[model samples]
Target: MSSNQQSDNVLSLRGISKTFGAVAALTDIDLDVAAGQVVAIVGDNGAGKSTLVKILSGVHPPDSGKIVFDSKTVEIPTPAAAHRLGIATVFQDLALCENLNVIQNLFLGQELRPLRLNDVAMETRSWDLLRQLSAKIPSVRVPVASLSGGQRQTVAIARSLLGDPKVIILDEPTAALGVAQTAEVLNLVERLRERGLGVIMISHNMADVKAVADTVAVLRLGRNNGVFDVNDVSPEDIIAAITGATDNAVSQRQARRKEGLSS
Candidate 1:
């Protein structure tokens, strides 16, 4: 969430707090995702990154506060309802079945059926989506297991876009990929932004964050620390925010510096 992102917040989360029994997974989180921007959320282990995504994906509900999607504050209680509102989440696994063909995997649960399953229409629609996204997979009929990791990932993302989602949240997209595959995934993310869809990328790799993110948002200990334009801050500064080792990141490091002086 950059300063530029502050101007046109497509998604606004105000004081969103969530708890589980005695465990406070998130507290007082405020974030904004503007149109056509990819915001990366970086943090360490137990930083509550997964929990935050669950909240956005309708796996968990906030105990307090509000979430505004497309200017209207709303509550997302179920995955299907979230899909209806155009929020899609791609998990770490990419979630594609190896035995299935590209088109079969793409339209798995939501197969298009007129009187019966419309195989021709479904495959044609898949082809159209691949073309629209400019994805590089060669054949839609090939088994997913036969394709490279990057191509399989492309299928996962293409499936997400079928609903014309307003925002897409990607969880550790390149965590297990090789250097080449990582680059490919980053390029795909760039295409997502070019298509005007808001992107929330969760990664442990700052390198990946710096590569494709328009904005960087830090979550330390299940709380929003700060959000900044990628060009406005350094990687070290972002790390400081992630560890809460520096002063106040939300207030632009001034609060932390002033506190240091007073102390």
Candidate 2:
């Protein structure tokens, strides 16, 4: 985590540690995300990035930690609990039904049926949500299979908003998109922040992180390597933290010299 902390964070985690029997997945991690902010979690493979996401999503309870949401410390023990606390997650596999239309997919599990199926209301809401994000979907009546990769991602993200969540966790949202598609999704992320929602994006794409993230948090070998303001740090330094490239003898010598100069 960074040495500085935000005074009005919507979500704050402290000393969060988790283990998987013999392997220590995460150790003493700290993170803060404020409303209208996009925090990107970047790490190399097996660097405990996914583990930390699971803990936050309530797929796995942390072995030790404190989780504060809206300035209140609370325990998230299940996915339902996380949802109840206004936390929503969109995993890499969008979980959308290709055979169903946009509206069908959006209200699949939680349909807005008072007496019978309210198709009109559901379809209208689907369009409203997509319009809010400025999504480029062709029609809300078309099957999801007919949509492009970016459109499918937009649908999944829009579905996560059904409950009016305050925080949204997106895992590799643009991992499989083309250049144009990636830009479309990134624009949606910006809109989410504009709506005052806290966004946590887990991605390996440094370019994407640097493009949209307000803060970039780097994890190295199950520990908090560093958290940087995206504008203040260079891509080279962020990559160094991800690969431990800055820990060599030459880098250490340079660090010592820089410290001596500062002293």
lDDT per residue (tens digit) for residues 26-119 in model 2: 9999998999999999999999989988888899999998999988898999998998998999999999999999999989889987569999
Which residue pairs in model 2 clash with each other? Answer: none
Q: What is the C-alpha RMSD of each candidate to the true structure, in Å?
A: 5.8, 4.9
The number of the candidate with the highest lDDT is 2
Q: How many backbone clashes does candidate 2 have?
A: 0
Using Cα atoms with residue i matched to residue i, what is each candidate's TM-score against the true structure? 0.89, 0.91
Clashes of each: 1, 0
TM-score, candidate number 1? 0.89
Model 1, span 1-263: residue lDDT tens: 46664558778889989888898888998878877989999988888889889889998888998999987889999888789989999998999999999999999999997459999999999999998777888899999999888787888999999999989999999988889888888989999999999999999898899999989989988888889899998887898898887645545566677799999
Model 1 steric clash pairs? 247-256
Global CA lDDT computed for model 1: 0.88
- Residue 191, model 2: lDDT of 99
